[model samples]
Every structure is written in C-alpha cells, then in structure tokens.
Target: MRLLDNIYAGERVSAADAVRLFELNLTELGAVADFRRRQAVPDERVGYIVDRIVNYSNRCVACCEFCAFHADAGMIAPYDLSFEEIIEKIGELVVGGGTQVMLQGGLHPDHPLDWYLDLLRCVKTSFPHIWLHSFSPAEIVHIAILEGMSHGEVIGRMKTAGLDSVPGASDLLVDSVRRRVSPRKCTRGQWREVMLALRDADMVSSATMTYGLDETLEERVEHLCFVRTVQDETGILQAFIPWSFSPANTRMCEVAPAGGVDYLKTVAVARIVLDNVDHIQAGWLTEGPELAQLALCMGANDMGGVLTEELVVQAAGIHTRLTAADMEDLIQNAGKIPMRRDSRYQELGHEG
Candidate 1:
C-alpha cells in the first residue's frame, strides 16, 4: 500500500500495514511519512519544545509493578513540596526561560483534592501566563476516587484551579493488559472516560503508548487504534507519543529492553496509523538522546522536551536529560531546524 493512500483512507491500517511499515527501508519510510505530514501541515516547521517535568511528590499508593519511582509506604521521609518549595522551583523554571510545567507525581495516598487544587492555584496565580500542562488520567481518576467526586467535576475543579491541559497518560490503553500490569491505576475504560471529559471541556491533551513490555505487535497496533478511536470521538487529543517500555528496576521484564530499531519501527507505524493526530513526539527520555535525534528522520517531528528535570523515567533508571540549548543542537545535528514551542506547538521562537 502506498503511504499517501494509506493516510488518505483515514482508517487504522491492518497488521499487514504494520508489518510493511516494519519492513520498509528506514530512509524510505522517513521520506514518505515526512512528505505526507508536510502536505497536511505545510506551515509547521521544526523545534517543538515543552518544559521540564517537576515531580512535586514521590509518595504514592498506586504501586504499579512496572514503576520504579513510587516511594514505599514505610519510607523514612516522604516529602510533599511545601508551597514555598514549589514556588522556588517555578522561579527557577521561569528564569531559565521555561514555557510550560508538567506537574506529575505518585498518587500521594492521603492528600485531599484541595491539596492539589491549592498547589495549582498558587502556581497559576503566581505565573498566570505559563502553561500549566499537568496531570495524567490515572492521577485524575485516583484523585476523584479519593475525593468522592465525579470525573467531570474533578476536571472542572482542576480547570478552575488552573490546569491548562492533561498529559493523556493512561499507559497501555488495553484493559486486559492494564489489568495485569497496572491494576491499581486507572483502568482503560476509566482513563478513556477522563480523556473524554477533558475533551468535552475543550482541553487539549496527548495520548501515549509504552510498548516492549509483554504485549504483542497486535496489541501495540490495537493501542494505536484505541487512541485514534478516542480522537474521532472528541477531536481534542493534540498528539500521539509512543515510548518504549523501560525495564530497569521494574518487576516486569527485568532483563529485556526495547531497542532503537524497534522504537523507530513503532514510530513509523504510528505515523501511518494515527492519521488524525497532527504531531508525534519521540520519547527522548525513554530512548536515549541519539535515538531521539534519529527519530526525526524516522517520522517523529517533535523531540519531546527541553526537560530541565524529570524523575518518572529517571526513577525507572533511564537518564537522558537535555537543556534547551542541547535540544537545539540535537535538531541541528539531525539536519532539521529546531523551533522552540509551547504546549500547543505554537512557535514561540527559534533556538538555532
């Protein structure tokens, strides 16, 4: 099947398409997908950037078997960021020319919904112009359950408290798989409901899939189809970000790790399948810096972030950090222009 025709069909390509995508010469696949994206979004140029992930709390009850970042219940000192501590972090972020804040953390077992609300309000009231791109669907569901609030009400309160958007982070969007992997977190249906609610409220979010962890290729494609189906319903999902599952200190896949070729192949298929989503972000955090740079040529336009600090993937034992200048260098090294961007991909400026 021709790439353009496959894209125009506006449907999820079959497993055969995924296999074909996998078999294509890497350069050939890159050229075809890049060309298609250009035709659809002509004015867009390179250099999509998001700010650092500032994890405020490490305490969590959702002790996912796949996670290495969750603090155990018997830890000596579990610190939640005091308002002043959070403000200090934000002060550094702003002065460093950061544009957005990705505030995610473990599900602090005992904190009230108001605890999150107050922190959000403090950040927004202090820096109203900064994009507060925070929270995942799992966190939302957990918070709602803890607060005894409906998902919609939780989103409303969050928006009122200053949430600019959600991260769409319900990893492995298939229920049977999730039930085995992250049973304590939000189920697939619950995650979808949360995203639907955010979409209904006119918020933009990005969907993600972390593969290379006990799921077959069919399951991977199924996950892509699920995200596309949601996009068809709500039309508010902004991007699709597929990251390889990191098996560092996690209980699952203790020795197996996702390779670069696998990562690129997944990106190629994602570009072919998720025709509705405008942007595809390469997870620089999960796949090292070099692979992330290579991802630009392999169908990913956005190299995820100028992440000043990130602990989620780091705790899982992958440490590939990049500054704003470093990202500009990576884009240039990949032979594409790097254009600095905000949460919505509005070109704020160019770094190089």
Candidate 2:
C-alpha cells in the first residue's frame, strides 16, 4: 500500500525499493501500475501501430550471444537487401495500409554510410507519407564506425536523409549484463549518447529492456532508472518497451526462457518507475497476445505495432503474426478501446 501511495503521490522509488517490488504479488504490481497508468494517461484507449519490421540484411559483425538472427561474416550466405528489394517491401507496406516501417538489420560491417543514406533517400523518395522509423542506436554506431564519424554526426546525417526516428534495440543497458550478452554492440555510454542526440535532433525514440539474459533484479531496476533519468532530462522518449529474452536457437539456448510472471512484473515496474515516459508497450511478438493483453492492466498503454511482418525475433523462434484487426480485437478484449497510431505516437483513428 505504501508503494502505491508513494507512486500515486508522485514520488520516485529508490532502486533498492524497486527491487523489493518483485517480492509483492504479481497482480498487486499490476494493480499499482494500472493506477499509475491511469494517473498519467487517463485515456481508456490503448494505441497500436500498423507497421512492418523490414530486415535489410542478416549480415552482422557484432557477436551477440543472444541473437540467432545474424549471419556471421564469411560464414554461409549473408547478404544485404538491394535497394530495389527494400523498395518492394515498402510497396507491400504501403499496400497493406501500414503507416510505419521499422527498417531493422544486423550491423552490416561492410556497408558504408552512403549506402544507408541512399536507402533512406530511396524510401522517402518512393513513399513520402510513410513514417521512416528505421535503424537502432547500434546501427547508428556501426555506421559511425564504418564512416569514421561520431555517433552524433551519423544521426544528424540520417535525420537529413529523412530518418524520422530511431529504435532502442540492443539495449540491455546495464554494462555488466551487456558485456555478457553483446560485448561487441554499443556500450551504455554510446547508447545514451545516441539517444540524447536523437532528442537534440527533435527525433523521439523509445526506451527498451531485453531482460532475462542472466541479469540481476537490481540491474533491471537500474535500467528503468537510467531511462527515467534520460526522460527527465530530455522528455523525448515516447515509450518504454520491456520484453523477455527468448533463448530459442541462440548461442544461449540451453538456458530457460523468462516466464509470463516475470514479463508482467517487468512491464508493471516499468509503468510505475518510468513516470516521465508516457507510453509502455508489451511485446506481443515475444510474449504472445494473451499475456500482452493482460499487460494492459499491468501498466502498458500501447499494444505496439501489428507488425505485418518481422524476422529477427522470428529467427529467435518468436513469430506471432497479428494484423491490425487482430491487434484491435486483442486490445478490445483487454477492455480498452483500440486506437491506431503512427510511429510518432500520433493518433490515426479509433477501431471502434
């Protein structure tokens, strides 16, 4: 009750106290988080996006142990999608009534900066109205590595080339946990730097947590605190998405995956802790729509995108294909009005 009272009174909980939240009942956590969600976002409408995730290349240089999506360099048939091929994907998205496309890919070590810029140009040139919510902080850093430029410089150039926003991918934020899982990916400093740069460029992005990768409970709370700090400073993060780690077919496949209880607890804690971040999205792709529906009352305000198509998580053995209608039904079933939104969190329309 004190936790709920404190949260409702708008006080920040310490990291140690946050870790103790795990000891409480799952439904209690969800109830407090739902209370906070109502306090911040009183709307009974939950937002969903009609978007597709496009993987431009499976080629990767980062030796992330958790990823089964990447094709290691010089091993097997790793290839980048030709610009024309990418355009075709965009065409499908346009035809499918998709308002956004998440252009995700491995850190293609061979591609130059111009190659990415050209792709952005091509997308904007071909589809002017589609929100180009592409690339992760990791990808930006990779481009910087290839181009011998700063992360800020790469982000600025991408913005110039019509990149509307960035995704908070590869963000297991705690450096110790990150070193264990993705030592070759961007560091916490680099991730924070890129996010701040996006804020400076007026490009809002999401904050994410990919937990269950052998991280401590305190570390999880640390991640929430870190994102909240950034939000307090910039107030530009549009949402926070917490997803459980899927170990299927990965190098770390021997480990057991995070369960539904952990997923709900993380989502609820995120909603309660990330007081400055307006939105919290549950990953239906990884957690399934059933639990994702339960996550609505557990302090999630967004159902995320329908994801007409996806690949990375699919490679990790997660493939939940939900259309716009499926997403609307799921949200409605959760007792929330289903509202469609763009990548920028702009309300497009209501389903009912």
Instruction: Tell me the TM-score of each prediction against the true structure.
Output: 0.93, 0.97
Backbone clash count, each prediction separately: 3, 0
Instruction: Give Cα-based local distance difference scores for all models.
Output: 0.80, 0.86
Evaluated at residue 131, the lDDT of candidate 2 is 91
Off by over 4 Å in 2: 73-77
Q: Which 10 consecutive positions of candidate 2 have the poorest summed lDDT?
A: 72-81
* Candidate number achieving the greatest TM-score relative to the actual structure: 2
For residue 7, what is the lDDT in candidate 2? Answer: 76
